[model samples]
Target: MARIGITGHSNLTAASAPLVREALVTQLSLHHDRLIGVTCLARGADQIFARAVLDVGGSFEVVLPAADYRDRKVKPDNAAAFDELIGKASQVRTMPFEESNRDAYMAASEHVLSSVDAMLAVWDGRPSGGRGGTGDVVQAARERGIPVTVVWPEGAERE
Candidate 1:
């Protein structure tokens, strides 16, 4: 079994979703079976990764930044997907925070990086949005000597 973690853009546009999904699924296919995908279940990349994991007969382990992260951060349009993915997670780990914040997000990112064998980042090869963003997580994973694969197919655009 291979344990893979994901971090990526949260503002991916509708038109770019399929390209990201296809690229992600193709990369994950190399692992064959018994895949364990660890993610924060955020919108965009996280949700897409979770779906790919399920489609490939893999399990999901969700690491939430806060207890009420979904309600506080997830938009109404994406709430259903976030909720459904979280509900289907094989394991749910919430950081020790009541609300979503920078510290909580960092802690969750640390947990994902530390627990996974490798990380799949659906990044745009740009700087992070802020602390605990895709760039930060990828850097931390690299520092920890974990393999970090960047997945950004051409023509992928963010909203």
Candidate 2:
């Protein structure tokens, strides 16, 4: 079984979503029935990855950045998708923080990294805009000797 974690841009361009989703599906298919996706369930890339996992008949786990992540971090426009994915997760883990700050996000990413075999990053090779962004997660995974696959499709772009 392969337990793969995900980190990516949350503001992907409209056209990039399908491209990223296709790439995720292709990658996840390699593991087939044994795939287990781990994600923070953020909008854009995280949600796309979760859907791809399910489409590939793979189960997934979620790592919430904080207790209030759903209420505080998820925007109204994305709440439905966030809740749906949460309900479908095989397991859900929440960080110890009450607020969804940068520290909490980083801690949650670290938690995901600790349990996964590899990391799938949907980054465009740019440095992270914040402390717990895709780049940071990818770097952390590499530092821990976990293999990381960058999955920015040819036409993928950030908003």
Candidate 3:
């Protein structure tokens, strides 16, 4: 199976969600039947990608930054969607941490990059805001010689 990992903006605007989802589904369709998506399943891009993967008849592997990542990082509004996606994931991996932190996030990011055959980044072409941001993961993927596909449709903005 072909494993494709996802990393992208956590604060994507609502207006861009559908656009991103459609583009992602279209891209993943090229892989046909042998597709497995790996993602951290955070809000925004992660959730969007998971939906696209499932829509394309692909399984998903969720990587949590910490054991209590959802409790610590997921907001009440996004909890339902997050929970639904988690329930649909074929596998769930949690980092060796009690709570969400920079180290845990980086570890999770590295795990995704190392486990996938390729990576899909839904970025706005900006530099990463911090260590475990999309830009950092995309750079790491490229340096490791993994193919990286960047998806940022015109007019897609962050929330």
Residue 21 accuracy (lDDT) in model 1: 95
lDDT of 3: 0.93
Please provide TM-scores, in order, for all candidate models, with all chains considered together. Answer: 0.97, 0.97, 0.98
lDDT of 2 by residue, 1-159 (tens): 999999999999999999999999999988854899999999999999999999999999999999999998899999998999999999998989999999998999999999999889999999988899889999999999999999999989887
lDDT of each: 0.92, 0.93, 0.93
What ordering of candidates by lDDT runs from best to worst? 3, 2, 1
Task: Rate residue 131 of model 3 by lDDT.
Answer: 87
Q: Write the per-residue lDDT of candidate 1 for residues 1-159, one digit (tens) a residue.
A: 999999999899899999999999999999976999999999999999999998888999999999889789999988888878888999998898999988899899999988999999999989887898888898999999999999999999988
Candidate 1: where are CA atoms >4 Å away? none
| TM match of model 3 to true structure | 0.98
